[model samples]
Target: MRTDDVLEVMNELVAFVRVAEAGSFSAAARQHGQTPSAVSRQVARLEKVMGVALLQRSTRQLRLTEAGLDVLERGREMVAAAQATVRVAEGHVGVPRGRVRISAPKAFARQVLQQPLLSFLQRCPEVDLHLMVVDRPVDALREGVDLVIRLTDDPPPGMVARALMPVRQLLLASPAYLSGRPPVRTPEDLMAHSCLSLGEQERDNRWRWVRGGDVVEVAVSGRYTVNHSEMRLAAVEAGLGVGCVPDFVARDALAAGRVVQLLPDWVFDNHYQGTAYLLFAASRHTAPKVRALIDHLVAALGPCAQPV
Candidate 1:
């Protein structure tokens, strides 16, 4: 191919990358202010030129073929280089200035990140941030988010992840409620008491405790079952039942004597409890603004750091 033909091929490859990263042609089009059909054609053209099918399309989501994955890495590098070139030309060289979209959980944002994010804005005036605070799942790759705060033992692949802190499940109950109920000496003793859980699913009421090599799983139910951490903490404070909540959510309550931890020796495993992680898409180039915010959060939320 000649020089102009090469440029067209590069454009098609870049479009394919965007569609793949966005998880759908429609999402990529929306993000880029283009039509889905246009994006779809670009990807199809690229596939035809490359002589290989890149994606396996399904009703719900797009899945990458082996060749598509390899092409994605190269195309991502091309996009990153183009972005860096534009930034340099725009006089943003080595400067952390721009809007960064982020996704974080609601309770974690309120309890931990909100204040630090405010402080970061004050420290870096040129960098703007958009925080999408929600408890529901958000895909960092397809959501147009620059950063994501997640608590998971195993983070999704194809992303760069940093472990910030351990999220513990602290078993708790109000002093008044615990005063009336039998002491929870063993894990089996929880069967006698009402246990509050997220109850978003059947397994939320089921909990597993780990102590060294020993493991204990219990099934306990309560009248109030809500997915919100703060709401569950409120229920525990009202002496509704025993509760297993995130340590950070129960921190203020535990310090204020509103609730007391039942078993300090055992650790519980749940959907919510895991190592807190900061994640971003893997790339040869990371923006300065995203790096700044990640460093600030790690300093504030990491172990041995002073609480805000």
Candidate 2:
């Protein structure tokens, strides 16, 4: 191969690696601050130079072929090596001063992360902060978000993910509603009650309740359906029906008696609550801004930052 041909192929390899990690060109572009169309063209050009197919693309999804996956694994190592070479030359630079973009769920952004983040920004005026509230998982590199806060049972592959805390989901209803209906003392009791459901695509309306070693899945029906957590909470508070919600969202309300917990002995199991995570690219692991934000979040969330 010609020397220039090899160099051209290497560049394509980098683009391929980015696309694979991001899962879409649009996401990769957001990370790199380029247009989605531009990202597509670059990936296409790289494929042409390499004389191999890399990605299988459709309107809704992008998948990596065998060759693409191979390239992605090797390419990440190569990129890390290249970054290490630069870091060694530049040495450590203290005090991160730059913009940091973070992505989180809409409800979380408003109820959990917003205040603490504002405090973080106030303390570090030199650091510009960009926050994006999203309901679905976002590709950190593709969406141009420096970091992502995810509530998941498992982290995605090929990224550095730190668990923040274990979250619990609670089945709750307003006291006004529960006053008229029979108390929910067992999973079977829930069948007689109406339950507001969230997430339009959710197929199972069964609620899980676990006590000791025993678990029960209670089938529930309701007149209300909403995709937003806040709306669901509002409906439950309005005495529409019992709704399962995250502890963070319901904590204050529960304490204030605005909503009462049902079946305190039983906990949700199948959609077993897991830890929240702050995920970022391995490449930016040592960047000053990245390090500072991670430290700040860890401190803010406290014991939530368990190892791994």
Candidate 3:
């Protein structure tokens, strides 16, 4: 086939893949800003070229035929390759002008990452961003995001991780709260206090800490339980109880004397204790828009992290 012929087939494959993944022609049309008939025709053309029935269409749902399933993986590869080609072409241009989609956790995105993202957009007026703040891990290529900020001790396989900061979970209480309660001199002392905690997991009530070669574990309870870090911090500030929170969430409050860090000499351990890593597909790092955002975050966040 000629170059144009290959391009045409690839374009039809793109449309088919989108429609298949979206579950309906109308849905694909809405997502891609194309007419339903246009998308449907593209799929039809692809079926004609391959001489196989790809989809079993119905009034309620669309199901892929066996041939469709066989072609789907290759179609995804072609689309991804084409997207990478576009990104490489964009990288050659002098200016960073494009949309960069990213995902981050809810608490970190709102409390910490929001300002830096705004700062970057302000500096690079030509670039636009789509930020998805969700708690669950997101797949960059599958989710159609440019980058993912994940909190993990080790980056997952098949992705590049740029270390942003070390995330430390700190046990804390407002000075007002501590004034009324028994002092938390050690992990065992926590048994006497009302400890706010994330009740999401059974182990949440079982808090652990380490100092030098010493290890301490405490099982405690509170009047109120919440999974949200900010809410727990607020409750602590209001003197509700001792709450464990991310260092980032508690840092400013600690600095302002709104809250006091408990067990300052010990390292708190459990969920949410890991380095915040900026994750991306290896091929995506070279794209100028992605590179710009990555660099911007590195600069903005470097000083905030404790030395590893």
By TM-score, who's the top model here? Answer: 1
Q: Which regions of candidate 1 fall more than 4 Å away from where they truly are?
A: 1-92, 303-308
Model 3 poorest ten-residue lDDT run = 299-308
lDDT of 1 by residue, 1-308 (tens): 35575477988888898888899989999999999999989889888877889999988999999999998998898889998888775544477889889988898989988899999999999999999998877898788999998888888787888888889989999999988679998788999999988878878877888899999998887889888889999999999999888999999999999999988999887778887788888776677888788789888888542211
Off by over 4 Å in 2: 1-92, 270-272, 283-285
Residue-wise C-alpha lDDT for candidate 2, range 4-69, written one tens digit per residue: 875766766677788888888888888988888977887888777767778898999998888888
Task: Score each candidate by Cα lDDT.
Answer: 0.86, 0.80, 0.87
In candidate 2, position 35 carries an lDDT of: 88
lDDT of 3 by residue, 106-219 (tens): 999988899999999999998999999998889999999988998888688888778898889988888878776678899999899999989988898998899999988989
TM-score of each: 0.70, 0.67, 0.69
Per-candidate clashes come to: 0, 6, 0
TM for candidate 1 is 0.70
Which 10-residue window of candidate 2 scores lowest in summed lDDT?
A: 88-97
Per-candidate RMSD, Å: 16.8, 17.9, 14.1
Off by over 4 Å in 3: 1-88, 303-308
